[model samples]
Target: MIKFLSALIFSLLIPLSASAAEYSDGNGYTTIKTPVRTSDPNKIEVTEIFWYGCPHCYSLEPLVQAWKKDLPSDVDFKYLPAVFGRGWLAHAKAFYVADLLGMEDKIRADLFNAIHVERRNLNSEDALARFFADYGVNEDDFRKQYDSFAVNSRLSQADAKIRAYGARGVPGIIVNGKYLVSAESANGNENIFKVVDFLIEQERQK
Candidate 1:
């Protein structure tokens, strides 16, 4: 159910067309008309909004991980699950649930591999519970947290941010809440960080 729904939403809404790699405004990156304020006014925030079921996102995951490894002390990095539909909403909720349980980092890579590599059907609650059980999280406890207020509240916040971003695709990168980058804008998945580095410096100089 979720798999089909998410794919439908993704295909219908996201424009995957590649743009010129001018490495400048409107080419490699786009300026958000209305900048969404960053969570921290002091640090430069780089947020990557993605979906687990997105192949492009999964491909870029390794690059994202490598890029963020040596982030400067003044820069803050975050990940927000993209919510395009109920299917996405379920994944978003699961993200927060994993965070709340202190298993986000541990489960992040495996979850992606489960869907993309292992080809597992993790589109349902029971499926996710079974997956979590491998990490020692009981099925009932996992479900309880999956439906908890904390996760839902985080989902609401993410949904609002997604709307604010006007994002039409996954593996979207937002720099300081002012500039947006994606494979479409950045020419390709590999060049995303190049444009992001430019934007980060651009913000730093301001």
Candidate 2:
């Protein structure tokens, strides 16, 4: 009888799933040491830092898109392209260019498809020009906006924020500039938003 009771208690103590796992600092997520500045002062901000070439980011993007639609009014969400080096810069530039032209929504998915699905080489100015042109942004227009002061500034700021957060991987999610949720921390991509939502509520209570 005691052996059966001990077994039952142990099973009950275990979390049902990764989603049901208790989220805490250094477990499901971590507190950003530097606590980077958020876009809004009055609202909770969730930033997903991603690299287009990342397979994990590709997997997580769909989940992110779906989860963001029903966010609370006080929550603000944005995507910050990760810039690890010159190799990652082109895609980051592509993100800001589409963002500057207000075409981010249109090209966001297709661009990811072109790379991950179609295996296209879109890491250069010429290739990006052609891709954007298909989406109605001409080469000259794409280049002009790609190198615009605003886009350049955003790129620089993104690099700084990721460094401040001490994120060593792509597809990183920063909540209210305080907590960071990654695949490893969340146990998998599927549970990232669960951890993110948990942090958002924690921030809300504060």
Looking at model 2, the pairs that clash are none
Task: Return the top candidate by TM-score.
Answer: 2
Error of 2 at 9 (Å): 17
Model 1 residue runs over 4 Å out of place are 1-22
TM-score of each: 0.87, 0.88
* Best candidate, lDDT: 2
The residue-by-residue lDDT of candidate 2 on 62-132, one tens digit each, is 99989988989999999989987666899999999988888898888998999999999998988999999
lDDT of 2 at 91: 93
Q: Could you tell me the C-alpha RMSD of candidate 1 in Å?
A: 14.3
Candidate 2 error regions (>4 Å) = 1-21
Error of 2 at 119 (Å): 0.7
How many clashing pairs does model 1 include?
A: 0
- Tens digits of per-residue lDDT, candidate 1, 1-206, equal 99999999888665532322336778788888899989999999999999888899999999989998989998999999987755676677778889999989999999999999999988778888999999999999999999988888888888788778878779899999888999999889999998988777777888
